[model samples]
Target: MSYAVPTTKKLIFDFIASRDTVSKGELLQVFDVTSSSLTRLLDEMTTEGILEASGFGSSTGGRKPILYRVNPIHRYIIGFEISRIGSSIFVYDLQLNQIAHVRWKMDATMTPDVLIHHAANQIESILQQHHIAPSQVIGVGIGAVGPLDQTDGVILNPLHFPADGWKDVAICEQLTAQTGIPSFLENGANTALIGEHWALRGEQIKHMLYVHAGVGLRSAMMSDGQIVRGAFDLEGSFGQMIIQTDGTRLQEGSNYGALEAYASIPALEKQVRTQVKLGRDTSLHPYAPEDIHFDIILSALADGDRLVTDLFHQTGAYLGIGLANLINVLHPERVIVGGPFMNADHSVYDTVIQVTRKNIYYAPDYQPTFSMGILKEDAVATGAAVMVRKAWDCE
Candidate 1:
């Protein structure tokens, strides 16, 4: 359901939401308003269950001041992540605390209609189970693979989908109609970075970059606390970065030796399959080359398979080369690298870091710290929810 909030209330809510507690005088000082007018506004919001008195604050002089906080359960937000590998739904309160969650794998059967219907059903079931009404739901936010028509909320023709009916899908309209709630869509990589940024708000890092390596390489950046979106909504364009001029191009129409040709999970799987087909002895030989998958390779690596380890080393080297180029150009304060495959293995991550440091341009007194996403698999979903809350605050 849509909520129409006055600009004054939004400013008040924004002030309170960013802090642990806010006194009425503090609000008055932050915003220019009469003492009696501010008191009335606070009273109205408190009566409306949007804000609650959370006891008193330390007194600078005279009596202690009454502090207030945004009611965490005032309204709920829904976040959905639709990716080629799987989809996840998460319910969060105004404070962005996740209260309910569900996830499901994707296959050829999970077409646009099928997946959206399932998501609507799950959302209904979650709200009912949590005793939250439809009116209490602020809106739904979706972070999905690109390229997306974000302004119109359409899923443009993204490549490598398991299903065939994904081209030009009106995902936001369908979701909003099915669930009777306003919905917003964004690129998955951007949402993931937003999610991580929210988690690290206390750190006050102004510049950051995020890379998610899965079926493809997706990336997003933030500078001076604002997300840096490109003219075109193509998050996977990072995959087209040419790391090697003479490198192999696995698919037609792809750049030779692009980042995806080496860093992505599909590329890693293809590498292993090709080596296995060439009669390279390894633990994964039990499965046919066509049947080999990313999970199978991970299992083989877990067992210390020599063939899988060598291929990972090569993949990490290429991935590091790509990261080096990005870091050198962007010079972000922090870089987060995580997705399905990145979170699954630490050895590959370590190798990528080593190679990136070896190849990255050295700038005096500049070193970008690299780490995996704190939210991990749930990063995009959580970020979607955060965006919804942010929109409400803006309104």
Candidate 2:
């Protein structure tokens, strides 16, 4: 968000990040400006040690053009994910390689002030441990669960965090004030999408849809290589979308059944718990009613438990319907499903994919490759780092 960095320079830097290496001719052909202007910017960045010549690129009649790349160790950034259950932070080098990481379970009674101090302290501690100076840091990036004002970097009332007086918290401003490092904030789902994109940069994927299946399902889209954040950054509301008209209600007084009511992690677990309460036998015998958990359900599924598999089957079927609705409308080439739900057996993933193809709206060639994020838990945090890099575009 720094006004000091030029947009053109950022575009060039991003081009280098996207392509493994690039020559001046490629930048000239891509950018609208004259070669002289591009040369000046490249020269200035090179002089500052942000960009360096790798070697000569392929020749086409004339002398070969010199290739430029980013210096990986020139600077670093910290990306953070603040959640009610757990918060994690990581320091990444310029090339997006993680240098250090710290994670902690949230204190159940943590207040807004305590939460801020905890994050700031952890950031400082990690910096000291890695012998990194604040001056060498690009910024601190935060990806939090949102109902947030991303443009203003304000976190609105989050659903899970039970902190006292936690309304409209200015996460970016507060963290910047506390740590004196520039800060950026984004939707956790969006950050995870960005991380997926960064990891798959070599694929040259211009558009993709990302689904996070945790307590509830949330999604973000990348269209034409940019985040498809609609007005108010409130576009991705796939969870609230109706799945069944006469299906079970999530809460009383709601009209139609929503996607999250049947497909989310909590929903799946709730079904299992209900079946158990109804005197259904379970493989999860040693555990009491209160002790039933998602892990236990997964363990039972591994043991070929019929009840657990049926529960997952229902959730997967409903989720596939939701994904089909999105794909028919969005038409993204890639659809990535991730989060805690991925830990389940492949039957769930396979069922979801099968039902998705069946329900896909009429498009013969509209095949979207569905896959899981390899970064796993680190996707959001790493995307936060990329956000800061995109924000500050300069070394």
Candidate 3:
């Protein structure tokens, strides 16, 4: 079933969520509803604890109107971002402020049970530290590597992490049982898009795409004021879109000739390593292989190193091809690039823009805006928190 008085509640919720307080007249104008209707809804909401009259507003001539606001301190949320390198946990108040954060690297041999236990322990510690009651924690939102079955809260087969004996584990159910709270699981990239939406006033941007490029590339689509999770939540797996045909042999999980093979950070590092072995180098000679990260490549490009610049440009072009295809299909209003590689320098942006412009099928007047993500580095965590907030509102 849909939300009761969905339009009215949305208007009220958005107003209170975005501002410190609002007046009855303002609500009436914002919702474009009759005075009687607005009064009924506001009164109902105030009685339901969704909205509270905090004080009186300044009077213009007659009696002072009452000010109302959402109760920000009455609830809390826990957000988790699970990556191959490590996992991060954050406790956010109803207003989305981070009350606590914990980050710890995972042992390479850690199983799903062990990892979940560790996470549960960290969450319990944070809740205790903040003196937050278990009931006050509305939900736990998890952003994890995919392919995920969000409906079932199961991570089917993550590419990088060792699933081993952990296939089809019920992540949300397990976490919910462990923490005594509801849990929501989503693709990491999707979470990043949610985070961007929450952080950048996303209610205005009804259609947009968020591209996450780190060790691998994935994308999340937000269209018509909602995140699109296609057939079993596998909609935004752009990494599998084929882009090249000559570089390497195709594998099962690997997108044989996909843009990720050329544009991902690991791909760039491999390119640099190959150039070094071919004795065609510049400034990367002194550092070890471990030091050849995306940042190092960007630093080399900044110094006007021709090889690294060419690599970035090449990577950007490949990324542009993939994105251009996406634009032709989705027709979003904007595309926000995230992840460590896209965050490096303007060269990447310029290259992606130039190539996308040349390849896109849209008319000149229909060009979609492209920019870096608003919550670039912390998008996953922020999205997780937003997911929790959404869950709380639904309850």
Model 1 over residues 16-103: C-alpha lDDT tens digits?
Answer: 8777789988888889889998999899889998899999999899899999998999999999999999999999988888999999
* lDDT tens digits, residue span 75-150, model 2: 9999999765568989998878899898887655677677888889988998898888898999888888777887
Off by over 4 Å in 3: 1-15, 18-20, 29-49, 54-62, 105-110, 162-166, 245-250, 283-306, 393-395
- By lDDT, the better pick of 1 and 3 is 1
lDDT tens per residue, model 3, 1-395 = 01244465665776677677889977777777898988888888877777788899999999999998877677788889987656888888877777988887655666788888888998999889889988888788889888788878887767555335456878899988898988888888888888887776734788988887776778888988688866665533687787767555224556567676777777788888788767776788887766676667778988999888888788888888888888889998888887767766787888887888787786686888888867676788889888766654433
Candidate that scores best on lDDT: 1
TM-score of model 1 vs. true structure: 0.94
The C-alpha lDDT values of all candidates are 0.88, 0.82, 0.78
**Which structure is stronger by TM-score: 1 or 3?**
1
> For model 2, how big is the CA root-mean-square deviation?
2.7
Arranged by TM-score with the best first, the candidates are: 1, 2, 3
On TM-score, the candidate that comes out on top is: 1
Each candidate: how many clashes?
A: 0, 0, 0
Cand. 1 Cα-lDDT: 0.88
